[model samples]
Target: MITIEQYVGKWSENEDWTEVRQAYAAQLLIQVNKLLEAAKKAGIELKNNPNTDSLISGTQYGGFRPQSCPIGAAGSSHKQGQAVDIFDPQNKLDGWINDAILTQYGLYREHPDATIRWCHLSTRAPKSGRRTFLP
Candidate 1:
């Protein structure tokens, strides 16, 4: 499981990752961990290797995006600390994840075609409200 620092990363003025740390460190992190554990139990191995600019070495941003950071769209779940992007360079995750599993986890992800290198999973539903929706 990723730490709150890994989720918040080096963004905005919140260098301490205190912004929304309560939620991400507690609830969001648990959800992400359980989902990942389920995936691992299914024989899916997610490598911890993504070239991201985060404080945590050898880790990518788990979800939270500071407003000062230029990443996701405005009003994005990430900015609200409700999204997580798991590194999936091989695209194995996107291929393996289906609507049933998403429903089971109560999570949503960007469509496979839209997110090529990483699996963008979010606690927030997309505008389309699909388990896997277009970004």
Candidate 2:
């Protein structure tokens, strides 16, 4: 099981987030840990947490951006404690692990082709299994 301390350790590395945001991020991490453990039990290897330095330096902003917006723009989910960008330099795997697999565990998001790709996972429970950029 992932502890709160481990979650905080991972969250605190991101310099872009303020103390208040970091607290929210830590809570999100806890949810992520539960999802990750579920994925692991099913024989999946989720990517490692992206380096915070890389995430902070790679983009000027962070959050949910509309599909029409340019790449690297901020998106709203980041501010609401429901999403995170998993940076994988090689692009070896789809930003999201198999949606089918994730769906079984109640996680969902959309992936678009852009300069920088990051896996966006949400902790929010939707009424139906659908992708909503604003949610």
Candidate 3:
């Protein structure tokens, strides 16, 4: 689990979000933990090397992205603190894992296209019963 400070540090540097940061951070962390737990149960190992900018480091873990970020998609769940991009530069996600296991953990990969290798998991609400694309 990452600290709220770690969660909001990058964003806070650009603006004063003291009061609202905790709420977003908490929601993000909850989902992150849930995913981690599910990975454990599914016998999947997450990227853990210190050099990797991953959820384990809370650095470039692909959590909230400021609207200014070039990669931030319009109306993206990432802007709402309800999404994360999971990727390991050295290895792809375990091939044994499937969509069913991710859904069971309250996470849905926003994109399933084979070319889009990274896992974009989100907790966006009012789900449109849609599961194959990022907003």
Tens digits of per-residue lDDT, candidate 1, 1-135, equal 566656766653465345454564456667767888888898987777546543122243446666555776766777777777878877888888999988887888889898877788777777788998987
Off by over 4 Å in 3: 1-3, 16-22, 49-53, 56-61, 90-99, 114-117, 125-128, 132-135
Writing each residue's lDDT as its tens digit, candidate 2 over 72-107 gives: 336455544455554445433343356565666556
Query: Would you estimate the TM-scores of all the predictions?
Result: 0.80, 0.47, 0.66
What does candidate 3's lDDT look like per residue over 31-96, in tens digits? Answer: 667767667676666765353344533345466666666666655666656666555333345353
Ranking of all predicted structures according to lDDT, beginning with the best and ending with the worst: 1, 3, 2
Using TM-score as the measure, what is the rank order of every candidate, best first? 1, 3, 2
Better of 1 and 3 by TM-score: 1
- Model 1 residue 13 distance off true place after TM-score fit, in angstroms: 6.4
**Residues forming the 10-long window of minimal summed lDDT in candidate 3:** 49-58
Candidate No. with top lDDT: 1
Query: What does candidate 3 score in Cα RMSD to the true structure?
Result: 3.7
